[model samples]
Target: MHQQDNGKAETFDVAVIGAGVVGCAIARTYALAGARVVMLEKAADILDGASKGNSAILHTGFDAPPGSVEAACVTAGYREYLEIREKLGLPVMRTGALVIAWTEEQEAILPDLIAQAHANGVTDVEMLSREDTLRREPGLAPSLRASFRVPGEFIIDPWSAPLAYLGQAMAHGAELRRSCKVLGGDFGGTHWDLKLSDGSVRAGLVINAAGLYGDDVDLALIGRRDFTVRPRKGQFVVFDKSAAALAGHILLPVPTKITKGIVVCPTAYGNLLVGPTAEDQTEKDVADLVPDTLAALRARGEEILPGLKDHDVTAIYAGLRPATEEKDYRIRHHADQNYVTVGGIRSTGLTSALGTASYVFGLTEQTGFHYDPPESVHWPTVRNISEAQQRDWERPGNGGVVCQCELVTRREIESALEGPLAARSLAGLKRRTRVTMGRCQGFHCTARLAEMTEGHFAVPMAEATGHD
Candidate 1:
């Protein structure tokens, strides 16, 4: 599996495992800070992990208690998201959010929730009177009595956020080795001895952000094993874009100590996202089993958004949260091992990724390790919104529509095939161009798109389905 690149050995100041939101953000942070970073992902593409498939809510972290690490990190990452999104020209729908209560008992929690929001430094949060709530969102359930309206809360296209981060990292001198699984590693005195699927990669620092399989990655050689993670599966049903306006603001059920309840939120892609059944499962391919939860999710979603019954479901998907037994983030540095373990990132991982990276970098600093910036770090420049992103395909050969289900054109597919972040599977194209993620679920478009990728990338038809 080993392949030589430009007849030279691959080396870096730090090797980041897993290209999920947290891992990519961490690698981007280091790359921007002038570190020679190399990212190793087990998958064919980056951000295809839980990062691409998430709730898509930009939380104010108001529901989190004050002084908790989760609170601090989410709050910080929320602010950082605005800056990064704007800088990258990514679309962030700053439409705000609300937590609605249906009963009197649920109403009682509103005041305390406001207090908690304030405690978390979210000062813009306010308890909405019945009239005020109606004024803001008249379409809300008429039975709702109390709610917390928090501005600055928004919805984002979850796919582009992490991809942009990793894209920026790659532009800024970070090298990414896709589908290169790290078999094991040894804690070198300075550089860690890495055993990758391709071959070996040496790094003075190793950052582990392997999500669900994090423990397995470090089990071969490690130090602190204070916590264990149980995979909690969350199933979601995506409604067609036509029904996206079903809710004006995010409608969230108050969370219990065990789990955050189901939420109905509108995504930046102009689609409604509902469900995400909080069930605990150990299955690795959880997304494939989401059909089993569809009926339950439909019932639960109707209870939240009644008007959504008529909207056709575009797709149903599930992503497993690496929920750990630990109450807070399981981030720790082994100075001697020259490794940092970033595991147990749950559903809120996306909202806290940037902050998590910054904190991890601090841990690296406190360890007394230092690196000079690489001599040459070139960042690839791309438009904030590509031509294909305009909903029109006018780029010569790229303009022929391929994925009719999502209005994705051949130009867009080809761009993904040849661009910096290429697509090797059906799911990869879905995340990048949102093709086949629409109402038909690629029943018609899958074949054409598959043919295009097969011809363009020389990949076998079977492997193009995103199956290993």
Candidate 2:
């Protein structure tokens, strides 16, 4: 295993093997608990997995079955998210969620949904009449019979949430190693001897939170054969923030036996989102999404909410769900081997991140690694970057609107490029700063961003443009 520059083989209490939303949350939780925690991510930054792309709904877990792991974690995580968001002051549009029923059959499903939500202990749910639904969300298809008004399900800023967790963890003493890929590891005596593509770090315990590739990590580490994963691709489209008032809340269709279908939800950035058509594929290519699937999402959006077409689409994105055949999250702990496996965290991973972290940490504790709770852990209150960063940004070198479409100030891009976890490509920068993810879809910003990425990362212009 490669060692750090200091040559001191530092042993942490635990090492999280992915920096997705769930893994970051777990590392942050452990760091707050006074454990020497380290978060390892393959990409240049965190949230580069299923965490970056999703419906962004703070789900009520109304559809999950009672007594299920997903139900418990989601319920607990929702509450935890509320507290964290309050403390962090991150953006959250609590517009609520409405599962609309257009047909009579779909309308009949609302009662069962209400029953299921109640079974999961999700109270404060209301069954709204068609009239009330129309009044609340006049942009609906108008033929709706009723809707399940799930007040707890709201929309939040997916990008900033995990970043905030990581920022706090970093300030509170968690080491985040970006661009460090864990190739494989073995259970070394008293610790796990971690193997990495770039470098390595040893910890008392290893956590497999690698998102879509989580099972692969598990199989590579322990050769476990209990489960398999298939990446289910979902496509979403964003509308301008001015169109946010086109609907008052998240408009969801009656979920079928297959998936929740596409949804029209408002995002924390004030933009409106419509999408997520689920399609199963055996590949784990997170970057490439089939354009045909995205087209289907646009078609469905037009059908669900007629007013969705009234405005221009800001951007289009695709995310792969870490689908497991079991259709449930696979979280396991091996006390003897000092490993924790977190897999099949699909559509609900974003909402259940905090609770999942708490649960996973408890499993790590079962392995008997001693952890001392911190004496007043003070996380950085970072609503924005420093004044110096702002000043440095107004200069050149990818300055003056690297991504013009998103209004990403040159300062923001410079800060991202030179921050603790600097991005190396347009895609990496997009994940960090939301550049080129707005209206015009990088048409105006591509040239400038590509040039800057080429200059900084030393990649060919064609390569940068090709990737983005």
Candidate 3:
């Protein structure tokens, strides 16, 4: 492991701040292209912020504004994620999507959406009448006036995507430091010197993919404030797996300019999701769940899918998006400063992650950074062990099942405990193995899980409850 635990100063060819999906993709791509890289995160683990929350939908750019960065990145990233999902053996549910209009006002927007879809390079969208829409999604409101079928959209395992990128990056010699916040930085003409919470690092090139804190990091690096990340709080509700059958495909509402609107979709893990009430806030670091917001989401969900609110609510959570004043992403390259800032990557960031990485790499090249492919490098996969691949050390030999709700076995927990970027917190283990992420939501499993990580995190059982 190249992780610097002693908080000593270091140097690298490339340094990426933030370990969200986009940051991981940037670091991983740089490493794959043979640049020494390091990924820094303020949180205890990657994918711990908005990257893991929000609607985990892989958009096809069907409704993105024409000629926008989001449109291009989403259109390209959706395709790339599909290919990479298969290559990494990650879980992805290609449930397609239905953008339905239930009111006359909303019905009037279908043509424009279709036009936007075509403009964004997505030609697979099809228009459907009320009858056809109901036939496709019987649970949807019978008042549906029309629908647009986007066949390319999918529901992906959000947790594993970042892990795959970071895993490959680490295997290719990139280092990852958790809980390492960038306090400040200075451009030294030849290189950039960054002061971390524990130590410092000197890098030839710096890329800021910091999610909610991008604005703060940008100020530290460039000493200018071109944009501010408005924390848009979005709350969601998850229904038990039993409700998954109610929605065949991801059911979306006709989006408006301000938000994508609440959606009801089936997750890759077999649970139905309804949510994401978009409410922009003045606070930049918001993570609280407003009970009223969740209630309103349920009410809206009932209208989208008849009887949807009746389903047993499994969990409810909120995520803060990094929205900015500009409608487009705040990606810029400073050749003189040897820096790139990737900011304002709001809701579509998950779908646009890989494509954004490619774009950022191009920006880096413009700053005189060169990339050359290595002969061979290791790539890690978190594909759950199949019955056929299970080893004695992975199963009954290690211990017994720890989290039965998610079917997370003892071997999985052990693997997380001992793996690279080892699980040092309950949240870390949850992101890695999906433990404590079921209907019970750790009520039945936290005790055992805490014991397993006691030595690793040195925390008590009560304090080991998973963090948001």
Candidate 4:
């Protein structure tokens, strides 16, 4: 990472605003393309915005609008993830998704949904009879009328993927600046001087991947706005690990025009996930979890899988999606200013981030600012934290287990604190190592964590607990 001096400004080929999943991927793409890339995040750590909370499902683009930018990016990204995940040590739980219909009206739409899936190149999608559906998933409610199987949808480690992307970018000579907010900037025709919270940096181009505050960044830096960010909050409920056995596949609801509706699925972390009620609000930063909405989600989960009523709720979280007035992604390039606005990326960003980065790179290339591709690209592998793979605790010389709930070892915590992409906050640590995020929810492990992370964080452990 380049340290900005008060007397001198650091320069780069590209400055990517926002270190969310998209921003991380963008940095990796540009860095691999041989551009001196620097990714900036406003938060204390990466993935702290809308990227923090998600279903963690890698979509097949089966239900995405055919021929749309989202669909194209999702297809390309899905392919790229599969191609590179093993090298990067990312985990994927191959739990195919089932779109279930509880009513005749929903069942009637199954064929059309399947048609759309086929149109989107998911040729293996097939409709299932109610009998077949119940036979495949005996735990599902008997009220389920009919369903279709999307054999491609799978659960993934949402945090690790982005971490690996940024890590690889850094390994390839890219820089990451956390807690560095881009206040505004000036386009001097030849380059951009982005004013940061601490100091300014000059870059040949700027890409806005600020996520929830993408619109605000555009207005601040470019002095114009093409779209408005209507924050859509989605609340989720995670059931205990035991509940994961109740459903082997991702049980999805038939889509509505506005949302994909509530989905009852299994997480890569061996927990059953039921979520995300789409509620539109004006707040950009805060994603307040409403008790009533969560209760409704639990009820809906139980309705989808009657066995969920017997399971205990492990956790609840809410994330804001940067929705816009239009359904398609709001990506535009201003060649004259050497700026690109990658905005309105709602859900499915995790699956489409790589493809989005490639798409953004192509747009930047159109501006005639090109760099030679690197002769050698570095692939950095992140430590495995998901249950699908053997954890650090299972390995020898891992110190000792500190968080029994998640089996996080002392070595894992120590390593997470010492790296260039080190966890600077409790929430950041949780995302990196899964510490204090299990059943106990830090009740038993926080003290140990505090002892382990002392003097490493910007905020003291006592004050960070509430925020985490």
On lDDT, the leading prediction is 4
lDDT of 1: 0.76
lDDT of 2: 0.76
Which candidate achieves the best TM-score against the true structure?
4
Regions more than 4 Å wrong, model 2: 1-10, 286-288, 382-404, 447-462
The 0-to-1 C-alpha lDDT of every candidate, in the order given, reads 0.76, 0.76, 0.82, 0.90
Which sections of candidate 4 miss by over 4 Å? 1-7
Deviation in angstroms for 182 in model 2?
1.9
Supply candidate 4's per-residue lDDT for 83: 96
Model 2 Cα lDDT, one tens digit per residue, 217-246: 988888874568888888888887777878
TM-score of 2: 0.90
How far off is residue 229 in model 2, in Å? 1.0
Q: Candidate 1 lDDT, tens digit per residue, 50-137?
A: 6766888878888775787788789888888877665675676767888888889889877888888888888998778878887887
RMSD of each: 3.3, 4.0, 3.1, 1.6
lDDT of 4 at 351: 98
lDDT of 4 by residue, 1-468 (tens): 234535588888999999999999999999888888999998888999999988999999998999899998999999999999999999999989999988889988999999999999999997899999999999998988999999999999999999999999999889889889999899888878888998889988899998889889989988878999999999999999999999999989999988999988888788999989899999997899899889988998898889988989988889999999988888889888889999989899999999999999998787687887779877779999998899899899999999998889999999999979999899999999998778889999998888888998888797764755
